[model samples]
Target: MIYSEKENVKSLIEMSLKVIRMYDWLLDLYVLDFFVDDHWEKLPKTWRDSFRDMDPQHLGEILSNKPPKQLLPLSFLALIKSVDALSIPRQNTYKPAHKIDLKNLDNCKNHPRLKNLFLKHVKLKKRHEISMMADVVVDTAMQTGCNAVIDFGSGLGHLVRVLAYRDDLYAAGIECQRQLTEEARKLDLELEYTAKKHISPEAASKLHRPLHFNITLSCYSQLVKLPLPETMMNYGLIGLHPCGDLGPLLLKHFVESEHVKFICVVGCCYMKLSCEGKQQGYPMSDYVNRLDSKLSFPSREIACHAIEVYCERLMKGNYKDLKIHAYRAALERILVEHDPKLRHAPVRSIKHSDSMTFENYCSLALERIKLPLPTSPSVWSRGYHDLQQWRRVVVVYTLRLALAPLVETVVLLDRMLYVMEKGMSCEIRPVFDPKLSPRNHIIIARR
Candidate 1:
């Protein structure tokens, strides 16, 4: 359904900005300097005092928006409530879960076409995304009398293959990676061959292979030509996690193109948005621009994390797994102490971080940088005692994590508001489960 919730979306935009603006000091801090800069000591004493020794299990529950198992300050409780209020609510509106069987796609034996090639090659997370995205695109196409869909930044063309399954519609993909484009074509042919055995030769002949464009969206737009078939005079746009500027550019494409009827786009890589340049992704609408609610790079990066999954880990008593934050922070302190210039330097990935000691982590981390290994155990022993600092890290992280959805709310609302300002109908819905795919919401707009 096309959304007429401009007022509601605008109100959410305003509230999210208000809440985020109030916590400016917290969200803007670089996580790499959490210990080196003494970030924990900077937390409000009341918050620091309450969470200093809280059990991991309870903290998890609280972060998950459940009622705290024990009593806490009204201020603390109020902060948590604000996060719940400002953020976007989990949505099942787009996916007809009751009507369809997305509860388990792997176990599903419904689709005889393409055999397991359509679903088995991908993980459960991807299956959920593709299923919901395909449903939305197909539904929108049917709704708007559109017979085609242009997949913006369509990686691997999983959705393209699914759309090609229907003889009634045509599917095309715009991808930059040559390998993915080739692979998608291979998969499409495999799909057709496998599907022909299930249907008559006449039916198979009616079906078309998905068209693949092995060019970057930017490169394609620069050329300014869309040589679409006459049958595809009307089409919709579908993007499953078009990173950074690509998402906004697709919206711009929809607005400018006369043949485009509707759009279903999910975006990721928020930190890559050029907020200040001529090619800006954020502040798309005058509504958000007027609010002056600019997001920091750190906040936008945090917005990409799986908050539901993080909370789930916390609730399951997987405290050791979550210690990566404090561990990195402590490591940051050691690095900065060695060389202040080494602050925020990139380190190679350390495997099995949960089981490794801080000293072990330091050895692995420092070897890449060629920094002298700390000769003093007592000097570096600071990280050992401050292992309790994981709670502090979690506490601060929870506050920032609380603001994450609100951050996302503002970004998505900015896009929606931009579409609305163009005098088009726009809607936002959570299509994938947050635990499985946190960046699940898609912005749907119709002309």
Candidate 2:
């Protein structure tokens, strides 16, 4: 199944061109500050403190030699015909029809199952979508008559719970974090108790554990283990989000192994990957099947351009007065539900921490904007607190609205195409609820 060098290069070039387009779009937006919010100044006293010395302007900036917007979500090309579906947010709702809760299928989260984690300030929807999409892949594999599933980057075992809870599917999850795995194991014990006792209303407990989803845990990589594949011979396939470099590793394994019958992979965080023996940036040229000629280095301001392109789309309507909560709501909508909207700028204060002293992150943010600071600390603090929370909403909302129309669409499309060339089939669809997280779209691909 090794593709000829020319074919590989061609595919690489196509994917590279796609990323470049997204980069160009983002670069434009950055220059316009269309992506920045009134509270952007709060970044300095809060999150920006850690990277202050490293040139804040350089963070998330596009590179002169790097490819453009290489890390797009998966909602674009795979579900283009249903593009309008992207306009709705998927965060606030997780209809039970979309999921089967181990306890009671009737009371599932109307949004994606993992939405609550965002409230706890965990890894946003970006990571959550990866798990849900992987579930679809696993479901497809099971429907196709496969029995087992191997989940890479199992994290807290969210994806594993979704796949293994069913009696018909046998699943195993591998995670590198021991603490998270331990937590997941403890959670598993709680689930077993729930399933055994919660058969009736009389069994409900105030101190109940989440219903158990059966899945084994391990610490193997595609490079180090054939057991995952060997065990799947008569069963199912290996499904993974395979963030960054792990993607290529999965591909290499899929091609090299005979036991694996299917692979549904959704790759992200490309700038964090290495290729052809290099690190920190992707090398599309190394994996594509063919190309007319080696492509040149992408533009340096492409990320800004992509951001601008996105802003233009997001600001199509009356988006002049977006607040922090609204902004967050919008982002939650886009990431979870793929809803598209032109959100206004949010005016509020920003809060940094729950434990430490209150510094009115948003007051500083207003100061950065050169606005007069309110005299009363309580009023200023309350205003700023509400504003800061809303500022995050605005920031992510602006991000999604600006990027949704084309940039996010194009970049994710390229990823789907890349999967196709590697001999895998894919389906890219929107998840519900955007404000819940910015990284929406469930990308399910199979080999």
Q: Model 2: per-residue lDDT, tens digit, 57-91?
A: 22223211122233322432222223223322223
Worst 10 residues of 1 by lDDT: 104-113
Clashing pairs in 1: none
Count clashing residue pairs per candidate: 0, 93
Alpha carbon lDDT at 37, candidate 1: 76
Best by TM-score: 1
lDDT of 1 by residue, 1-447 (tens): 244777877887888788788787888877667887788887788877778788877887987868777778877687778878776676556654223444422221234433465784788988988878877777777778788888877788878877766424688888889999999888888777777666666666777677888877672264147677777667888889989988888888888877789999997999998897656899788888888688999989888988888778888887676677777888888777778888887875575465688778778877877766688877667877666677777777777776788788889889999999889988888878877889988888889
Alpha-carbon lDDT of model 2: 0.41
- Candidate lDDT values, in order: 0.78, 0.41
* Model 1 quality (TM-score): 0.92
Q: For each candidate, what TM-score against the reference?
A: 0.92, 0.48
